[model samples]
Target: MNLNLAVISGDGIGPEVVREARKVLDRIAEKYGHEIHYTDLLMGGASIDVHGVPLTDETIEIAKSSDAVLMGSIGGNAATSPWYKLPADRRPEAGLLKLRKSLGLFANLRPAILYKELQDACPLRKDISDKGFDLMIMRELTGGLYFGARETKEVDGVMTAIDTLTYNENEIRRIARRAFDIAGKRRKKVCSVDKANVLDSSRLWRKVVEEVAKEYPDVELTHMLVDNCAMQLVKDPAQFDVILTENMFGDILSDEASMVTGSIGMLASASLNDSKFGLYEPSGGSAPDIAGQNIANPIATILSAAMMLRYSFDLDKEADAIEQAVSQVLAEGYRTGDIMSEGCKKVGTTEMGDLIAERV
Candidate 1:
């Protein structure tokens, strides 16, 4: 198979981590007798420095033409970077938002799994971490509160602020179907999270999700209020298989879930449209402080590449090779600084990448 990919090695440690991901990908190509064609482009601070804009029409076009996008973290220290001085729409992160919008990405899959080897790194109690949870948070992106129309004004004497939170049946239904489809592949359980008691929007979300749930009889669907779901995450994460939620709730819950799994450096995320296309990236930030130190963790980005293979290209065997290689590397006691612990052999970013690639 010929894999055509758009590589966005964005700002700070993005280039370093993405380089490692590509190295592992190269190994996958060689071992599987497949071909990979890479179209390297820039976004975020790097694009800002060179093109004076975080994203360009040309970059979007190239991304659209590719089979999938493999990306690393974007942005720098927001307080210190010149890129942040630009208008809000021109900032590095704004480019990411634009890219997702242009690519028509609606479903975000964030897997927060506590690996057995990294169980000690988990912040949860020893008993909780020992149980080990592997759950997927299917977030409905490009909708809900974030995209709603909003304006703040003073009515009479007092000032008031309002951010519209809206969801239609079509938007709700599509994401619900995607969640159930993913759940069918996993453990066939979908825990739909919403704030139905308080908000009309969430009420509508539940109604539509229930309507879609009927189509997937094999997948078990349940509902939970967002607040209680948040508490339940740390209380008992292993209980969840796939969490399906709307935008704002999902945005908050996914971050909360990532924390329990140990390091954000070990988590990978993917955003997908209705089609097979996807944008894969690490769940962590660029870590500007460690950008040039060669100590940043690249496992997240490497796993992201694996997601591109599995989700976008349907190369399940190839993806398994990369994931198994990551597990093997961790089992060997090799670690990057972020995920390092006592009694483990700490390695630099390049060496860590080399270890995983050689294993693959």
Candidate 2:
């Protein structure tokens, strides 16, 4: 098998982590007799320095044409300029938003996987967290409040900001279909989370998910209010296989559910559409304070590479091998600073990545 990948090492520690993922990919390529071609592109602050824009047209063209995209974390204080202060299309984060929208990545899958060795790293009690949890949140990426209109003005002597929540039948159907498919592969349980009682948009969301549920009769379907779902995640995360929701709800809940795994640096995410090309990234943001320390964790980025293999290339065996390599590396007690417990050998980012790649 041959794979063409667009590598966007955005900013901060993006390059460091991406280098690790690429080494692992190279190992898989050699072991499986697969040829992998990687094309590097700049984004975020790096692009701003080179092209005076956060995302270049050439980069977008290459990304859309590639088999998959591996994005490192984007952003840094250096990218902030006085002229471009928080404008929707000019902010550092705008580069990412533009890529996702341009590529039409509507379904985001965020997996919170807990390694048994890292159980002591979690804030939750050992007894509850030890049982372990692995769940994915299927987020509807391209819709809802973030894309809605806001009416802010003086109304009867007071200023107010109002944001709308909206969703269409097709959007709900597509994302729900992805959720149901993922549930079928995992544990056959799909929990649709929304706020049906208060919002008309959520009511339509629930109605559409229910309509789509008929197609997957074998999968168990349930509905939970977004508020309750948030609480239930902490109480018992293992109960969920796939928690699907509209854009805003997903945005909030996925972050909340990410904590069940204990370490932010251990989570991976993938954004996809109907096409073969998808954007895979770490759920954690660029920690500028630790950007150059060589101690930042690379597991999330590595796992994102695993997702790119599974979702974009359909290389399930290779993906599982990479995942198992990460698990085995952790089992060997190799630790980065973030998830390190007592008596664990703390290694630099590059060394830790080398250890995982060696295992691969």
Candidate 3:
């Protein structure tokens, strides 16, 4: 197989972790007899410094032309610097948002898979979190409150802010279709979460999702209020197969879902389009405090490389090899500081990647 990948190593730990992911990919290519080409580009704080913009047109062009994109964490405290004085669209995180929009990546898939070996690392009780929570969250990335209308008004010398929660039928239908498709691939169950009781827009979302549900008769579809879903996630996360929700709900829930696995660094995400290309990334952010430190976890990034192989290149065997390598490494008691527990071998980022790549 031949593959061309765009590497947007955003900032801070982004470059560090992305390098590890690349190493894993190199190992996979060498072992599996595949040719993989990579084009590295700067983004986030680094791009803001060098290009005077968070996301350069050249970077976008590179991503668009590539077969797939692998993005590491973006955003840091450096965003508060004088260079960030540019317009709203020029912000570091805005670059990511733009990339998603430009690519029409409506479906953001975040899988929360808690391995049996890391059960003790979780903060929840042994029965609650340790038993293992394996679920996928299909978040509507390009729609809902995140892309809604906003207004600020001064009424009686008081500033009142209003941000709309809106979703059209087509947007809801596309994401619901994605969720149902993903559910079919996994456990054939879909939990569509919303706040229909209070918000009128959510009612429309519910209506649209229910309408879309008719297209997939074999898939079991259920609706839960966002608040109730949040509670249920902590109570019994395993009950969910594919948790589908709007943009804001997904953003918040996915972050919360990370804790189910004890560390955000363990989570990987894929922002996908209907086209062959997609954006793979870690669900964690750039930890500036530990930027240059070798202690930062690279599992998420490496796992993202696995996702790139499976989703982007259709390299199922290679993807499985990478995943098994990660699982095997974890099962062998290797751990990073964030997900480290007693009796586990704590290692730096490079060592961990080398261990996993060696296994691959």
Identify the leading candidate in terms of TM-score.
Answer: 1
Winner of 2 and 3 under TM-score = 2
User: What tens digits encode model 3's per-residue C-alpha lDDT throughout 1-360?
Assistant: 889999998887998899999999999999999998999888877788998788888888888999999988888775565545767778788888888888889999999988888777676788787457789999999877778889999989999999887788888888899899878878999999999999887899899999989999999999999999899888888899999999999998988888867777888999988776889999987887898899999999999989888878888899899999999999999998988888889999999999999999
Looking at candidate 3, what is the lDDT of residue 212?
A: 89
Q: After superposition on all CA atoms, what RMSD does each candidate show versus the true structure?
A: 0.9, 1.6, 1.7
Off by more than 4 A, model 1 = none
| Alpha-carbon shift of residue 76 in model 1 (angstroms) | 0.8
User: Cα lDDT of model 2 overall?
Assistant: 0.88
Off by over 4 Å in 2: 78-88
- Residues 1-360, candidate 2: write the lDDT tens digits: 989999998877888888889989999999999999999998887787788788988999999999999999888764454425646577568899999999999999999777788888676777778678888999999989998888999989999989977789999999999999889888899999999999888899899999999999999999999999988888888788899998888889998888767798999999999776799999998777788789889889999999999988889999999999999998989999998889898998899889989888
Q: Candidate 3 — what's its lDDT?
A: 0.88
The residue pairs that clash in candidate 1, if any, are none
Q: What is the TM-score of each candidate against the true structure?
A: 0.98, 0.96, 0.95
Q: Write the per-residue lDDT of candidate 1 for residues 1-360, one digit (tens) a residue.
A: 999999999988999999999999999999999999999999999999999999999999999999999998899998998888899999999999999999999999999999998998888999888788999999999988899988888989779888898889998998999899989888999999999999998899999999999999999999999999999999999999999999999999999999989788999999999899999999999899889889999999999999899999989999999999999999999999888889999999999999999999
* Reference-based lDDT, each prediction: 0.94, 0.88, 0.88
